[model samples]
Target: MPLNPEIEACFEEMRDIRRHLHTCPEIGLETAGTAAFVKEQLDGFGIDHQDIGANSVLAIVEGRGPGKTIAFRADMDGLEITEETGLPYQSRTEGRMHACGHDGHTATMLTFARYLADHRDFDGTALLLFQSGEEGFGGAVKIIEDGLFEKYKIDLMFGLHNWPGHAENHIIVHPGAAMASEDRFDVTIRGKSGHASSPHLCVEPFAAVADFIGGAQSIITRMVSAHDKAVISITQVHGGSAYNIIPDEVVIRGNVRTTDSGVQDLIEESLGRLADGLASIYGVQTSFAYHRKHPVLTNSTPEPAMKAAARVVGEENVRTKELPAMGSEDFAFYMQHTKGCFVWVGNGMDSPVLHNSKFDFNDHGILVGASYFAELLKEVTRQP
Candidate 1:
């Protein structure tokens, strides 16, 4: 599909910006350099912007008349993985890389910012949010705490990511849940320590640990409904200090993902109950802590996204029935307070999966994503 000619014209500059960001990848909430670069670009475009949240940049583009306020967010953090893509623009920062395509997302948002600056023909305000710490750093929450919703009466918001394993021109929109919620848990089982040979004399905590791991799976199979989707992964177990010594306490850590809020609630409650049950049955002291890292990303207002995507790619290329990804995104937190949707623009059918050392954001996504946001601006601005 041919992109908007105006947006297509910005491809070279966009690619340059994306490559520049790829070289100096920043991680977590420490995105000062990246935010400075974004602010510079906004200034060059004659757009008004300010610092918000932890090192986040928010730019404003006013329209011709009064209408609803819309927002576009792009994450600006990289991962701890080293870049192995071998591109000339590969990361210069060791032990950090834009493996998740946040660099590209930032570039796309910048492209749209430039376009909106020259042509603010819509009827509402456009907020260009360059967010930081999206890679599990609580950047979005920090921004909310910093008064994102309290300051602006935003009517709708939107965010997009480049998705690999699909055609480059494809645009995927989920009408309901787009990404799963992330919950982390730690289970500590305490018991008596003794010699390894004294199996009967010592209250080994591994028995309770083993039972908790097995019982955690039952929560999904037996407790959760068959129609609901959920996963409980036991990622870590730390216990023994020596080869033969029975440790006094065993710590178990795991992750949970679900598309439904009720299922999230169910799994958390069930895991706590199972931990208590294991303690009572094995005569061990158990403590469980569950932390909700990110909420489930639901498309509260998907029609505007669908229409905007149809305008960018062809109607046939806009997919609305894709299953929710098990992966989580901090953008989900914004959905809880506003009306909007998160979308996926295809990176490429043969591209490497996200967060892999070999992964790189497909540069063509810059035009595709920018065009979609431009169209979405028009869609929301016309709303009552």
Candidate 2:
């Protein structure tokens, strides 16, 4: 691999960008300040591009030789977690933090942007997508709807997530789903409310709610095929207002995830039936409401293209952890339009899990990720 010395020097500058953005975290697509920061860097490189749907920054570097247009993606949104890293440049905006490492993702891509602007190695084009609202609100989908392909005409896309714990310089890839589809539901069980002394005369929604939670847990364990994976968790359950009085209603909120749309549909069906069954058994009224979040994030593996890209980084750095993650990513929206793989680079086992109140993006993974993006660009351009 031909690593540019100037590109290597930009790592420190990339680190500076990461820390600056980390101090002032933004929430969603309305990242005016963050967008401006990225725009300034793109301007410095003299690379021309357009902003789609508010905060997503797209820059194109036309390669020197010959090839097709391939795009590189990075997320820029932060989470609603308070900072605890205690770094001198800790989050200035209290209760908002770069918990998902988008700070690093954004800066790393900026590093690659620097690399490409300096080297300009191949032909065709390189698209640097700095996306926002990826933590929620389907940012990738919003960009596509806003005419990403119509404007740039991307052929193959590549994205990497700063993963937690494996090793530095480690890269991963494969085929099929790399991440699961996430859906959420809320239920309200209703029953007649009466005095504690009149137990026989009144129906309790709490009883039905408890029965439903228990019954819902069984749906994944019993109704779902043992081989087929699924997750059903009741995150919240609230009912009685007093120890003795039977509450009029109980509310339960939960989330479900699966590797395919079929499994997600099954989860919805089973929950509805289970709610009906609980209502029937308890002689109470029950209601279920569901919201589908995002679809499966898959990659084309065997994937000589992606694997060759990984090899450019190094064989040891290439990982085989192709198992689907229950956590959902909006990048799934991008994969729907182009054949690509979303790989996770280790974030560190010791690091706080994403979205945690104390979580902060680790700075050490900067070059590891920048190098991966730079290498992937070179590899993809080399192929048809």
The local distance difference test score of each candidate is 0.94, 0.80
What would the per-residue lDDT of candidate 1 be over residues 71-142, giving only the tens digit for each residue? 999999999999999999999988999999999999999999999999988887899999999999999999
Off by over 4 Å in 2: 2-6, 64-67, 301-309
Candidate topping TM-score: 1
- lDDT against true structure, model 1: 0.94
| Most lDDT-accurate candidate | 1
Runs off by more than 4 Å, candidate 1: none
Q: List the residue pairs that clash in candidate 2.
A: 63-122, 64-122, 65-122, 163-345, 163-347, 164-347, 165-348
lDDT of 2 at 345: 75
Error of 2 at 374 (Å): 2.0
Q: Which tens-of-lDDT digit does each residue in 245-351 have in candidate 2?
A: 87788899999988877878888998998888888898889999999888878776326445554654567667775577789998888888887777777777777
